[model samples]
Target: MSNKTNYSYVGMAFIILVFGIIFVPRIVDRIKNQDITRNDRMSQGQDNNFKDNSKLIFLEINGEAKKVPDFSFTDQNGKTITNKDYLGKVYVVEFFFTTCPSICPKMNKNLVDIQDAFKGNTEFGVASFSINPAHDTTEVLKEYESQHGITNPNWHLLTGKKEDIYKLSNEGFNLYTAQDDEVEGGFEHSGNFALIDKNGFIRSRVLNGNPVIYYNGIISEAEKTDEDGQEEQISMLKEDIKKLLNE
Candidate 1:
């Protein structure tokens, strides 16, 4: 071959080799990273798709996993209550007064749905404790229960001593519960539903406030559903309840 031709051939080979060296590793690294990312996504999808079967793992209260103190109160039928009564059932506990003309109605409706959802499920129950013991007597709670058609055995509308309910709200659940004497009632409570495991330990605290309202109305008041509405809150609450039940 001529010298010029030979030089041309060698230069072409050198250029090809240099190009391969620069681009091949980058292409291979990109493929590897893409594979890793895909695998990570699949792993996460599988984790989300799988249903967890464990039941009622208690969350820490006051920095420790401890069973709440047991106490006695009266149900709407005037029966006494204690931790032993719910020893083998997962109970949902909420604090409210009958005269609450705001969030209580929505809260009660949600509880009713929950009760209906677990109608035959003996492992679950609902307890609505009166923060205004003086006003929320057994008779008053009975009337309230009747108003809502609460027929499920697992659901109880309870009224008790003011101090007892206050302690349960504040100390047992590690939540804020107080009386608003200025508001013409001895109680003004927050909207929270606590999931109490069979062992009397709290598993989750579901806030009953509807973020969409951000005011007096909760899920029930907004008849016309907005872009961001109560369904989201209800769905989250149901998922949390399921998780707690299957902990």
Candidate 2:
């Protein structure tokens, strides 16, 4: 071959190599970013669908979604509190009596942690219903709140008629609560905490006709290791709250 032709061939090969080095990585990175974005979109869509399809049923309504029953009670500060007061807000619901020496304290501590986690967010609140209204009057609940250092304005300790409280606990929240003379605390109540949506529907319990299951707080069995049980519940509760808030 002529020297000029050999030089031309070498120059062409060098130019092709330079172009490949400059553009190949950019092309690959562009494709990678596109894949990442598409995967993210698909993941988000699945998340939305999961949230939308997961329905919390009010057990009293034949496994249908229904609003929580209206209730009127007095808070620790002598203020009349009712379901109307928490309209348009997400809240955690629990059943307890002030004098109980069993799981009530642990449940309250967990609730305290939850309260601190969402502090200053007006969209969230906590409500504790006294199972023994006769003894857990507004003044008694006030003392209990003070003893526990519960200073959150959004946390309300409620006291009302015993019948009303029991009905609300059993029929409304779908929890077990009764005056059991045989029990240590003179009352039998579930330790589970319930998450209620802004629209007043119990969002933490699922009804499957056989029985309703609560999502968080104390459970009959730990789904994970004992050490991680409460932690996992808190984490799941936090995620569920975020989902409801976003929805």
Candidate 3:
């Protein structure tokens, strides 16, 4: 090739290399930044979905959400406990008798774990109603509390009229409680724990009355798989409490 043509080719190659050096990294950086932004948006969307799902109101009927019915009962300390006390507080509710030999022990143990998880948080608490109110008097509940080592001020073991307690269990908490001779522990009641929000509305329960229910104040499913479900529900319950507190 001629010298003039060779020099022209070399000059063109040099100019192209200069342009690539200047623009290639900027192009790559722009693409990288766009990918990061897209990922962030996707992550934010997933987080929003989780928050939305977690905040869904439970026990809705006829387009209206169900809330804890206003009632009065006596706690283990013989104090008048009512719905007013739980106003603006997030708490868990369960139905059990002190003498229960089957599920009540497990339920109470789980509750102790929950109490420990939110040990100092005033906004979180537990309300355990006795289905066997005829026998589960204030003194009896106090003994049960002592046996279980529940020293949290937020925990309340309550006893009240049998009719009132039964109605509250079935109609209010969406839990079953009845005296059955055939059932173990002389009572047939739901073993599930319920989550009530600050407004006294039940936010967690057996969805659609399904038997395969989730318990409030228990660890998450992932933790359950690893730890054989020990304290897993309490971890999930703590997460739910944080969500409500944030809201």
lDDT digits (tens) for residues 1-247 of candidate 2: 8999999999999999997555544433332234322112211111111122354433233334557789999999999999988888888888999999887887787777777777788888888999998898888998999888676787899998989998998777556788989879899787666777888876542222112234445422233324432323555566667767766
User: What range of 10 consecutive residues in model 2 has the weakest lDDT sum?
Assistant: 41-50
The parts of candidate 1 lying over 4 Å away from their true place are 1-57, 61-63, 184-186, 205-232, 244-247
List of clashing residue pairs for candidate 2: none
lDDT score for candidate 3 against the true structure: 0.67
TM-score (C-alpha, index-matched) for candidate 2: 0.68
Candidate 3, run of 10 with poorest lDDT: 40-49
Give lDDT per model, in order. 0.61, 0.67, 0.67
Please provide, for model 3 over 130-174, each residue's C-alpha lDDT reduced to its tens digit, 9 standing for 90 to 100. 999889999999998899989888789999899999888776755
Q: Which stretches of candidate 2 lie over 4 Å from their true place?
A: 1-64, 204-213, 219-224, 227-232
Q: Could you tell me the lDDT of residue 94 within candidate 3?
A: 85
Q: lDDT, candidate 2, residue 115?
A: 75
lDDT of 1 at 148: 91
Pick the winner on lDDT between candidates 1 and 2.
2
